[model samples]
Target: MIEADRISKTYARGVYALRDLSLRIDKGDFVFLTGPSGAGKSTLLRLLLRRDVPSEGQLIVGGRNLAELTPRQVQAYRRSLGFVFQDFKLLQNKTVLQNVALVPRVLGMPPSQQQRRTFQVLKWVGLQHRMSAYPLELSGGEQQRVAIARAIVNDPVIILADEPTGNLDPDLSLEIMNLFREINARGTTVVVATHDRELIRRVGRRSVTLNHGQIAELA
Candidate 1:
C-alpha cells in the first residue's frame, strides 16, 4: 500500500512539480495515473520509488516512511518494487536473458535461481524464444515485453510503470495493458502513469487525473 499526504516537490528554479498532492493506493489495487506532460505524473512515481525525495510532506510505501529511510534502507526498499519506464531502458550490449537476470544477480541470488526465474518470467511475457537476442535485434513490442519480464522477475510487492506502452502500436499497447491487468489479478499492486486517454478508457480501471500539479479528478 502507498500513501501520500499533502506531498509537494519543488525544483531549483521555483518550479513545483507537485502541489500538496494527497492520495492512497491500497494493497492489491490497480490504478491509472493520467495527466498531460508536466502534470506531475512522473514526479509522483519518482517520489514513490525513492528516486527523489519530496521537498515537503510525507510519503509512506509498504508501511515505511520514505523520508525516514537510511540510504542503505532506500536501496533495499527499491528492491521491493518494480519499475518500468517509457523507454525500455534495456542494456543494448546485454542479451535479453542477461538483462532480465541483472536484478537477481545484483541481489546475490544464486545462479540457478536466477536462471530459473529469469527464464520463467521471459516465458510469461512470451519472449522466451528471444532470450538470446539483444535489445536492438528485437521489435519495439518485443523490447517492451522484455522490460516487463525484467520488472516482474523478482516478484515485487508493487509495479510502477510510466507510459509503459508509449512506444507500441495500438494492439501491442492493449496487449501490455492486459498483461498489467493479469499481474494485478495475481495480487501485485500496479500503478501506471500515462496520458493515453483511449487506453485508459478501454481498460476501465480506477483513474486519477492530474492538472497543474494537483489531482483534479479521481474516478
Candidate 2:
C-alpha cells in the first residue's frame, strides 16, 4: 500500500511538477494513474520508488517512510517491488530466462528454486516457450512480457508500471493489461501511470487523473 500526504515537487525554474498532492492506494487494489506529459505522474512514481527525493511532503510505501530509510533499507524496500517501464529495459544479450532469473539469483536463491520461480512467471506471461530467446529476437510485446516476468520473478508485493502499454499495438496493449489484472487478482497491489485513456477505459480499473501537476480527478 502507498500513502502520499501534501507531496509537492518544484524545480529551479519555479515549475511545480506536483502540488499538494495526496493519495492512498490500499492493498490488493489496482489503480491507474492517467495524465498528460508534465503532469507529474512519473514524478510521483519516481518519488515512491525513491529514484528521486521529493522536494516536500511525506511518502510511505509498504509501511516504510521514504524520507527516513537507510541505504540498505531502501535497497530492501525496492526488492519488494516489481516495476515495468514504457521501454522494455531488458539486457540485450541476456536470454529471457536469464533476464527473469537475475533478481532471484542476485538474492542467492538456490538454482532449483530460481528456475522454478522463473518458469512459473514466464509461463504466466505465456513466454515460457521463449525462455532461450534474447530481447532483440522477441517482438515488442514479447519483450515487454519478458520484462514483466523479470519484475515478478521475486514475488514482489507491489507492481508499479509506467506507460506499460505506450509502445504496443492496441491488441498487445490489451494483452498486457490483462496480465496486470491477473497479477492484481493474485493480491499484488498494482499502480500504472499511463496516458492512454482508451486503454484505461477499456480495462475498467479505478483511475486517478492529474493536471497542472496536481490530482484533478479520480474514478
Candidate 3:
C-alpha cells in the first residue's frame, strides 16, 4: 500500500508543488494520475519514488515511512519498485538483452538465471526477436517496449510510469496501454501519470486529478 498524509512540497520563494495533499493507493490497484502542466503530478510521483521528500507530512509505502528510511533501505526500496519515464532512458551502447539483464546481474543473481529472467521479460514484452539489437536500431515503440521490459525485469511489486505514451502514435499508444493492462492484471500496482484523457476514459479506472498543487478531483 502507498499512502500520503497531508504532504506538502515547497520550493524556494514559497512556491508550492503540493499542498497538504493526502491519498492512498492500495496494492494491485491501477490508477491514473492526471493534471495539467505544473500541477504537481511529477512531484507526487517523485515523492512516491523517494527521489524527493515532502516538506511536511509522511509518505508510506509497503508499511514503511519513506522519510525515515536509511540510505541502504532506500536503495532496497527502489529496487522493489519499477519506474518508467517519458523518454526511454536506455543505454545506447547496450543491446536489448544486455540492458534488461543488467538488473539481475547487479543484484548478483546467477548468470544463468539472469539470462533466463531477461529472456522471459523480453518475450513478455514481445521483444525477444530484437534481443541482440541496440536501442539506436529500434523504432520509438520498440524502444519503449525495451524500456518496459527493463523496468519489469526485476518483478517489482509496483510500477510507476510518467507520460509513458507521450511519444507514440495513437495505435502504438493503444498498444502500450494494453500492455500495461496486462501487467496490472498480473497484480502489480500501477500508477500512471499522464495527460492523455482519452486513454483515461477508455480505461475507465479510478483517476486523481490535481491542479495548482492540490487534488481537484478524484474518482
On lDDT, the leading prediction is: 1
Ranking the candidates on TM-score from highest down gives 1, 3, 2
What does candidate 1's lDDT look like per residue over 93-119, in tens digits? 999999999999999999999999999
RMSD for all candidates, in order, please.
Answer: 0.7, 0.9, 0.8
Q: How close is every model to the real structure, measured as TM-score?
A: 0.99, 0.98, 0.98
Q: List ranges where model 2 is wrong by over 4 Å.
A: none
Mind giving the per-residue lDDT tens digits that candidate 2 earns over 127-168?
Answer: 989999999999999999998998888888999999998999
How far does residue 149 in candidate 3 sit from its true spot (Å)?
Answer: 0.6
Instruction: Flag regions of model 1 displaced more than 4 Å.
Output: none
lDDT for model 2 comes to: 0.92
Q: Model 1: which ten-residue window has the lowest total lDDT?
A: 139-148
Which regions in candidate 3 have their CA more than 4 angstroms from the true location? Answer: none
